[model samples]
Target: MSSLQFNAVLLEISNQLSAEQLEQIKFLCRDMIRKRELETIDTGRKLFNILTERGRLGADNKECLCELLREIQRHDLSDKLNRFESQSGSTDNQPDDEEKAKLDIATEVISENLGKSWRKLGRKLGLTDVKLESIYKRHPTELEEMAVELLKEWRKIRGAEARTEELIKALRACQYNLTADKVEHRLATR
Candidate 1:
């Protein structure tokens, strides 16, 4: 289509939804990538990027998305998409401030990597280069479980005095979703 045609199409689609709906579509596009069993997170990112390139979800695009949702057994989401009500975002698959990521680690691995860099430890623990927030957002249960295991192993190898910062940096490459209340803090006494 010509530029004007394309813009018109996008505007029409945009008019049918809210900003929150757009973001839901973006997230659904990403979830579709994972459901396809593509290994990399980049697949989801690319799908979202393509949708944004289209500028909005046209009727055909929306239908295609609903079909994909059905194929993935997300009938509720499919129904939601079908109605295209003014609802802003998805009510399901929402991650938890509730589903806290438990750290998972192997005893031998943790024992051997006690003094290594957090990055190195992350790699060794199979957290690899993926960000923790992504885990908390997209794959909450899996990564939270991993976090729990890692913390358990940390206490096993490094003892109770271990800092949450240690786990934060090691697993996420930075402190994330961590606060003093979540951990027992150690104060320095002269």
Candidate 2:
């Protein structure tokens, strides 16, 4: 999903929220949003824009919003968001042949350089602990394969939002700066 699409989703979700729920969201985000600013805001779109501007919401990251929805006991809204994400992936109609080839090469380079830090990168990429354990169990002695599998799983979950930049960010977050640079250089030179 693009930021525009993500914003649309957030707006749709915000429209569904009750006034009390909006206040609750503002309260929950007190630390990140200033009290004066919160008082001035009375709409979900504004709050979402602030969050997005702060890097708290995006196509590659929706955890905060999802958690907020769940915290507010709005599982239905959360599900609505998730459904949009999954369907957006399909509507994107898959990558072209060239993009697919580039992704394959990038994945190969990332998997090899990732080494034993695959799990850390996986966690940073939003893979659950249980999913990481399952991947590990499936390839106890194969580091490269484990890394590739983890990347594949992440790609599956992220779908259209799965970009090389997001992978680079996750790699850097896991302290794999060299690997991230390599990935960026590789994609650039391609």
Give the top-scoring candidate (lDDT).
2
What is the lDDT of every predicted structure here?
Answer: 0.40, 0.81
Segments of candidate 2 deviating more than 4 angstroms: 1-93, 96-98
The sequence of per-residue lDDT tens digits that candidate 1 reaches over residues 131-153 is 32322333344533444444443
TM-score of every prediction relative to native = 0.22, 0.51
Candidate 1 least-lDDT 10 residues: 181-190
Best by TM-score: 2
lDDT (C-alpha) at residue 114 in model 1: 35
| Candidate 1 C-alpha error for residue 161, in Å | 61
**TM-score for predicted model 1 compared with the true structure:** 0.22
Residue-by-residue lDDT tens digits, candidate 2, 12-109: 88887889999998889999888998998889989988888888988788889888888877765676577678778776745566766666877999
What does the lDDT read for residue 186 in candidate 2?
Answer: 86
